[model samples]
Target: MSITIDPVATAGLVSREVRDGSRDGTPTKIAVARRTYDAEQSDLWQAVTSPERIPRWFMPVSGDLSVGGRYQLEGNAGGLVERCDAPESFAVTWEFGGGVSWVEVSLTPADGGTTLELLHESPVDPDFWTQYGPGAVGVGWDLGLLGLGLHLATGATMDPKESEAWALSPEGVEFARHASAGWADAAIADGDDADAARAAGERTLAFYTTPAPTPEA
Candidate 1:
């Protein structure tokens, strides 16, 4: 699929932060992604929280969507909604692949627009962290922010197949590279070994840009 996105500029739209954290005495890592969109706070909140509109930018999500309710994204994680504050913030559990993490999204009005902040907290898995660093989720959020931007600007629904195709496109690869690098820098700022963090970022870049293999007889 052809894309008009300027990989560098689009990738730069979001700011990233990495930090060491914990929950219930267990070690964890927090990845924060923030982006400001040229849209009203309420409209952006609607786009993110309204089930009918989520698929237009993110993935198709189904299930109960209120506090104490459950939600499942068509091909991604799902869990209970732990907290919700209209046009302000919401927190949810992110359960996938036998792992449970936490995600919180908050919106604030800023400079004639709205800024969205996504915070993901995951239990520290030494092996996985060694292999991928924070880019594991950081780059993914970057893409989501980019999609949200497009949706707000054009009100166009994303075609799942085309979205998948765009990820493997040249522009997508470049964007992933930029995001991965940005996360690596954030990791370094968070006191990670510079070389190790950068190497892990490369692994993440490869993970996103590499296509799956096809089985043949």
Candidate 2:
């Protein structure tokens, strides 16, 4: 299930790379991305951390986001804000059932906009990786990143169901297709074979476009 995407084909609105020890202090590895938007830092930061702005772009997130404060995302899981440095960086305890991971989001001011960097790390589980591959995490991030972009540019949020459905649209498919290829290239840049990565990207796209099975035909 290891799918990869070609970042260059994505036109640099988003790009991915594998990095070392940011979430968990280990060398096992993590995937990272840097996305830049036209909005200023203040606007972007508020959109991400403000309750009023949460549901508009992303999900309804509730948490102090201050160090040591527990937070929950409405129907989603809850976790403590492991670290928080206003407008700059924050880390959260990514908990689900008995499993635990960490995710850190950081923002830095650039020439005209801000660079939003995200890092998520899970315990390198072979079984999980085998079933979902990189998209298991990458696809989720892609959604989150899109939320941020939509908020920055349009100052609006998308309906959850609509968003998911949109991901099946032609434009959405193209985005994912290019994104998957980009990730494949990233893995290849990290020493994997280019051809194999390309093939994985194709399989991943097929899975995304495939219709789910229903009961009673």
Candidate 3:
């Protein structure tokens, strides 16, 4: 299946900012992205929070899914649900590979549809940020949001193998390039050095577009 990159790139607004400290006393930074959906708030909420429907768009999720419960996304992060307010907002601790972060999703009724905002806050690792900037995570979420949009609009079910191939395709490269550039602009707006931000964005773009190394025989 083919996916259009432009609409996904232009469909949302993304921002980044640094925060003081997290629950664990680590310095943190946050990336926020918002996109409007043609679905109703309730429908959007259900699509996001429903474990049964998650795999249809995003990834397969399992585990207790409620306030204070733990949930895991297949081959991805797992965390405890911190808060849940039906059809409006939810917050969770996004734990992955022994590192903990926070993610929150909010839904607002807008223009007869729903506006979905995602906030992902993680402890600042100077090396990582310098090398990749927010595009590391922002582009990831952008892809997820794109998948969500496709699922909502046309009930699309992406084949996993095909999806992996698509990521390295020309269309995917374009999408990542645009997303990384936007993140570079956001970083500059957040007081980063313009040259540094642009350099980091270049690194991020290369990281996403380059093919992975093959295993030795």
Model 3 regions more than 4 Å off: 5-25
Backbone clashes under 3 angstroms, per model: 0, 11, 0
Q: Could you tell me the lDDT of residue 21 within candidate 3?
A: 46
By summed lDDT, which 10 consecutive residues of candidate 2 come out lowest? Answer: 1-10
Task: Evaluate residue 149 in candidate 2 and report its C-alpha lDDT on the 0 to 100 scale.
Answer: 76
RMSD of every candidate to native, in Å, equals: 1.1, 5.0, 2.1
**Which residue pairs in candidate 1 collide?**
none
After TM-score superposition, the amount by which residue 39's alpha carbon in candidate 2 deviates from its true location, in angstroms, is 1.2
Best by TM-score: 1
- Compute the lDDT of residue 48 as modeled in candidate 2: 78
TM-score of 2: 0.82
- Top candidate on lDDT is 1
Clashing pairs in 3: none
- lDDT, candidate 3, 30-91, per-residue tens: 88888888998888898999998888878999999999899999999999999999989999
Judge candidate 1 against the unseen true structure and give its global Cα lDDT, from 0 to 1.
0.94
Q: For residues 1-217, what per-residue lDDT tens digits would candidate 1 score against the true structure?
A: 2246899999999999998999999999999999999999999999999999999888999999999999999989999999999989999999999999999999999997999999999999999999999999999889888888889998888777787788899899999999999999999999999999999999999999899898886
Alpha-carbon deviation at 139 in model 1, angstroms: 0.9
